[model samples]
Target chain A: MATHLILRKILDTGFVSEPPPAADPALRTREQDLQEEILKVFGQALTVRHVDAGSCNGCELEIHALQGAHYNIEGIGVKFAASPRHADVLLVTGPVSRNLEVALKRTYEATPEPKWVVAVGECGCNGGLFGESYASCGRVANVIPVDVEVPGCPPTPVALLQGILAAVSR
Target chain B: MRIGDNEWPLEQRPGCTPVWRGRVPAERLPALAHDVRGCGGQLTALWGSDDRHLGGGFAIHVAFGIPQGTAWVSSDLGAEAPAYPDLSAVFPQADRMQRAAFDLLGIVASGAVDARRWLRHGAWPEDAWPLRRDFDAATRFEPTLDAYPFIQVEGDGVHEIPVGPIHAGTIEPGHFRFSVIGDRILKLEERLGYTHKGIEKRFEGMTAEEGARLAGRVSGDSHVAFAWACCMALESAAGSPPPARAQWLRALFLERERVANHLGDLGYLGNDVAFGIGFMQFWRLKEEWLRLNARLFGHRYLFDRVVPGGVACDLPAGAQAALTDQCDVVAMHVRQLKEIYDEHAGIQDRFVATGIVKPELAARLGLTGLAGRASGQAVDARVDAPCPPYDQVKVAIVTHDHGDVAARAEVRFGEVFESLRLIQELVRRMPAGPLLAELPTAAAGAEGLGRVEGWRGEVLVALRMGADGRLERVHAHDPSWQNWPVMEPGVLGNIVPDFPLINKSFNLSYSGQDL
Candidate 1:
């Protein structure tokens, strides 16, 4: 009787995900007329390798929220890769700590060509609070090239999705 | 239990929690530690601070959990070569803390085992100590990497698998080296501190009030508890007490944070085993709960919500009904989902007996908070030494003796229900008053300590005031410090693939502990 409850619970609570919101035009920093062709290249698929350089795990929590039923990124053909070698996009968080500086660079180099790097959170965009200090490099762009920067103490799940989409459209 | 032999009197600070402190000679700590442990005391936190500028030398501080409350004992060492007796023999958890103190302040624990650099991973020069009175916080050191020597295991079929500073999951950075034979792990060692962002060094720039924000970010997931601990310490130091109304709301926010983290962890534990229904239902419940946080307060994670004196914001209108209804809704869904998790054999197969930390090992290693509770080491700050509103509310202590992944999950489930009941009580009993209080002007040469049972474990913030009304030192200790070392013993007999499931069960914080 109890074993059947697992199957019954799934049937009772049907799919809870909604269609993700459309990408904001203001966040689309590029000219629309110039980038219509690039959208077709990787529009339906993107594999991300997330690097936590030194975040407090705020941005990480928001990114984890994307996998939930509310904003299911997997349903829309996006998945987080277990290895950087299998990834098409590198999603990095936190102001890069000095200890993980070389590790971040090596992980960036490990990714194959034609990969875009998106920096997530206020720390990633501008080194939020723990700015350049003895133990912190401060900001993702300071260490490696960043294609997109999502700025919030930690950007919301919707904002992260928009940032990732903006990177692909570029 | 009292700390010292009365050469120096212990001064009890004015705070909700009972914290007694005293300073002693460096030679007196070992005997004091032995006395505390003899009365069933546990090590709370250990750190070192530079005192050369004050005409004294360097000072090493240790806090221990005693029968009455927490006993904070400090000893002064001379400026030339500051070294204190090692307590790792008495408290195994003191090893890394001692190493971290040496790395930051250049104070040596006379005879510590495994004294490799803990937090200073070659990012700063060997001679450069960030916590010293003279070290400049603004100077940018050229980034350098260093090699860490992992102890090797030799046998007929022994091989090594080095895991990460980065992992497959969306977690913080920490490396794990596992030596295995035929998929059964013989031994595991973890090299952490990749998330050290000069947080303690950064605190020197802020006043006690501004230090609130930095404390909250020490471990993002435990923001409410950490900020509250800092505020409590600052309030006690400045001779100001938060209003009773503010205390109630702070407790509510704390329970909400606990609920949020437990929800996320339970959801991911199911995800680790590919249980689709459990992950969806639990996360859906969590999304609604976090949405309520953003709607009620201004932030989803409750960052900066708990301020220096009391709180940054008040409970909004309709909060009582909204929160009570959320408690009802979440309780219903969690009850339904937990039933599924309990009955599903696949989930149980991965959970039960996967990774075990026996009770005897837990006490000796100083495992604390929820993980400690699951392992039968019954220690919860809310129950043991209740602070402010927690003392007002009846917090039922929860525990299990199995010391496995299944027991940890069961504890989370039990705590969620208990927390929901508390949230209901809190909303209905909500009082009307001021949301935030003005902190007194910061004073120089004053010190204070704040301890809270954060979601992950015991969160302690030790603050000292500096010259010009700025913070001299802030050591935010996470329970992960005590718990992370035990994972080495936790995964001893477990297979490699089961590591993720076991780790998620404990769900300790990397950023929190690394700081």
Candidate 2:
């Protein structure tokens, strides 16, 4: 995990200096550097389609936040495509709701081959607080194939950007 | 059968009684429906509430609205079994609404077609309505699927495309069944209720104040609307008016909530049309605004800040000023984004003339809120049935002549300015006094209706007191119920790719409808 840096550095520091590269080519940025580096291995431009099985909109807010100027995932060639057919990455959120399970499966089915599924919240990963909801089938992974899991009550925008970048790099 | 103003049979009505009182007979339902339809009223919400406290009987409440006033009709069924007349024959959209009523309350809509379970799965026994009074809160059940009969769309080259209750993004659950030929959608059917939180069933025995708190959580984004409606019902039942300051505070919060969701949705709609840059810019500004919500209101989504009687916490003087400054910043940024969106021809091409819903169709379908307004069905509760602070201040409603994806987008953008203006006016004219007053002891058998304008549209809540002076049952209806079914017609003639932009333009709340 990246070290906690409060707003003081962002608000107070006049300018930022890049951190030095790690001793190894892999395991360099923070947790799982090798995983992060692998995202860059697949050079083809990536398009992501986002699906919400039944999110509280907490993670949706942050996932949407990644497009903001501060994070700017688009600058790194990560784009949100409207339909799964054009997507290389299928970004899923929320616990899998019984009502939405079939729709989620179809969304994946619509996407072309060589697609990767990324579960994008604690609920998506493991159903979180609403885990026991009768309407919720289970976690997103239980209903679909998830290659990368982004965990947090709501992962911060920076964390989401890092996760997406990691996927593209891999 | 005609009563004062509303035509309801006096005899055979659910008299105000202890335990479970005030339930109308099931036989009177068809008359009530005919009366409302004759008056050109719309079925606002239809859901069942548990009356386990009154024994095993569960009550189903049907609320309808005219231009200004709202009428409520409720019936009680056995604790083990409940039934209601089907309105889908009159109101085509009531099919799913009735299924939802069946899912939680276990009420069977007699002679109702398309009886697929709305929220309940094979996980729970059919005899067990999760929203029933005796259902254990901690009980866990696995999902079980029954036969879901999909209506076949037949023709040359016609095929079915079934989508999820589980999706790729962080959104509520719903299934999209499309019968398409080529890229053209011949018919589109949506199956929702995956996020049914059992909100109505959970309200059993809770004090009015406690129930209002849970109401706010129904859909996190529309906190003010749900909270205000619940509080209004409680206040009306208790005959306690919120303090002047609380009313003003509620107005401010409501406007902020409206602006924030509209902003986020507008950005996503634009993004769906392939306007990536527009999405990035608008969403960035929206995030900054929400961060300010966290600062000024405590929670990022402004959850729990709105409680019954009044707000849970008062705003510090500094926080008020900070909110004003942020509004100014957002206004400036929004104007810039608007310019880009308006001038971008490619984006405009994709949005304009797609998902066209004629004005007459909108009225017949009972469309409410922005979707209704875009199609010229102007029925904002804040304007018609003014309450509290809104009654004191004039609410400017924005309407559009064309009811298409573009019109919806334009309506939302226009509301952005109106909401910001409302925020400024509210802050400058905030009244002095306490936020809340002591709630009155609600009389047994008293009934009250609460209507608030949520960002999506008008949110209506109705409550009836039992003979024991507790909430017999309550109905919280989101505008989505009226709008979700309309998406089918809206997507017709438009290509499949255009559906996303059109869908985002509507941005209906699934949880709101599911509950």
Candidate 3:
């Protein structure tokens, strides 16, 4: 009965995933040939490690949305790794608060070479509403090198996928 | 004096609800807190404010959840020696709130048991109070390494496991120290404050309108709740209640936010147990739900939708039918999922009896929100103290006495249905009126408070108007503060591997509490 119900629900919500949105090639940060070489190594099997430096968790919610059925990002060979060492891309959100600055830096260093960092949300892009402060380190770039900055209070899931693609785009 | 017995005097503040606001002498701080708690009133929120510039010492404020309504109490202390009697003795949850206030405002809760720092994790110097009037918002000091001393448990076969300020997922940062033998956990101590961004200091001197935007972002998950509460305080102080249409729409949006969060949590809870189908179906439903939000409110999370005096957006023509349809779809899907979850022994085994927070422990530790309800403390702020639309809606409180993963799941399922019914009821009965109300310019020194039953729990925002009608002190409290501490107690005796499942069941907010 459980299996029957599960299968029934699956059929009821059939083919909900639509064609993925295209990322702007102009949003590319790495050099074309170098990016191509790196792409050859990673292919479509990209690994992501999300770091919430000091987010309100708004941007993190969008990122989670990207993993849902409508935007089945994992179907496209992108998997969220549990550790930075297994990750090829670091998807960071929020203005880097001073408390987590060292931790963020260490995570960036822990990722093996040829890593790309995608700064997410308005905070990660340019500190959002919480600009430089006594406790905030401002944007992600203030602490680490950022390859792509997706600016929105929290960019949509489609926009997040685009940001991730742009990090590796030539 | 028992508040439920009407012994203590509390004056009604201007605005919605029976929220009473008044100031008492420093000597009466502990007495008031004791009386409030004595009469079934739990401390809703506690924070201290710097008041030296106003020719008074630092002031401490505490909101209590009495049977009648929320009571916003304040105590003023002298600047020469700013110390209020410690509240930790009466209400243990005040330990962290007091520590955080001290970290930001230099106000001390004299003789509190745990005097350690709460929200200051080597971000700034000890003496540089961020919320003080003289402190510059942009002041930067060279960072120092924090050596936080975690309490130790020494016995034969006992070992320690340290978790995160950065975890293995798309979650917020907080440290967890576990002392256990093998897998069976003995004690779990959580050290959060890594996400503190000086939000209180950031709200200094902003126009009440601008403060609404900052409050909305205090915890993104509770934007509608936080923003509405902030605006409530603003509207309350300005002596302006929003139009009827605006209040109903706010209720509609608030319910929608509840459904959105519950959907995500339901999916994530399933995924934690490696139940792939649960993650797939629920999140898909959640995505469709969010698309509706974006279509109606122009933002997926409805950020900035709840502005001062009223909501920023109004439902377009024929939007009600679509909302009704979406609710039907979600309700249908959740019913199907719940049935499947009910019979699955493997999933049930992992969920049931895991991470138990007893009813006795829950009340003593001040467990709150959905998790609190699951633990058998049936204190829904909506039902307990109805303000405007909630008075009309008559929210049905869903609770479970088990206080385990399964029980929390039951509460989530029950709440989703209740919230759906609320959405339909809110729209079906929404009165016709202006969508926005112009807030009268508040006078300097005027104060107000707003309380909303957010999806997670009560979102209480209090503000005092500064000179030139700017907000002098704005404190936005998330239920996460009260709930996070309870999570530590919940994890006791659970195995190391079962930690993730147990933690997700509670699903407390790190960023919300850190601020």
Model 1 lDDT tens row, A112-138: 977778889989998888888888889
lDDT of 1 by residue, B1-515 (tens): 34443333577877778899888888878888887777788998999998888899999999888767788888989998899999999999999999999999889999888789989888898878988968888788776658888999999999999999888778889999999998999999999999999898888859776798888888888989999999888887777888888899899999999999999989999988988667777888899999999999989998888888888788778988999999998898899888878878888999988899999999888888998999998899888889877777889988999899999999999999999999999888877788767877667877788888888888888888877768878888888989899999999989999998888888888888787
Q: What C-alpha lDDT does candidate 3 achieve relative to the native structure?
A: 0.88
Best by TM-score: 3
Query: Which residue runs of candidate 1 sit more than 4 Å off their true CA positions?
Result: A25-37, B1-8
Candidate 2 Cα errors over 4 Å, as ranges: A1-51, A74-133, A136-170, B1-6, B9-24, B52-56, B78-81, B168-171, B205-210, B318-322, B325-329, B438-449, B463-474
Better of 1 and 3 by DockQ: 3
The TM-scores, one per candidate, come to 0.97, 0.80, 0.98
Clashing residue pairs for model 1 = none
Candidate 1 chain B lowest-lDDT run of ten: B1-10
- Lowest-sum lDDT 10-residue window in model 3 chain B: B1-10
Worst window of 10 by summed lDDT in candidate 1 chain A: A25-34
CAPRI quality level assigned to candidate 2 from its DockQ score: incorrect
Model 3 over residues B342-362: C-alpha lDDT tens digits? 977788999999999999989
Per-residue lDDT for B1-515 in model 2, tens only? 34324645333212111011134787667666666677676777777777667555777777666543555667877766568778877666677778877877678888887788766655466766677656775465654565566788998999988875654454566779999999999999887766665556556556776677667756656878888888877777776667778888888888988988898888788778776656656666677777787776775666666666777667776876787777787787777667667777777888889999999888778877999999998778788767768877788889997999889989988899888888887887888888777776788756666778899988877776765556756777788888998998889978887877788889888877776
Query: Could you arrange the candidates by DockQ from highest to lowest?
Result: 3, 1, 2
Write model 2 residue lDDT over A21-135, tens digit each, in one string: 1122231122334554444654646788888766666677777676666565666667888778988888887777665666688888999866777777777777765564556
- State the TM-score of the second chain for every model: 0.98, 0.89, 0.98
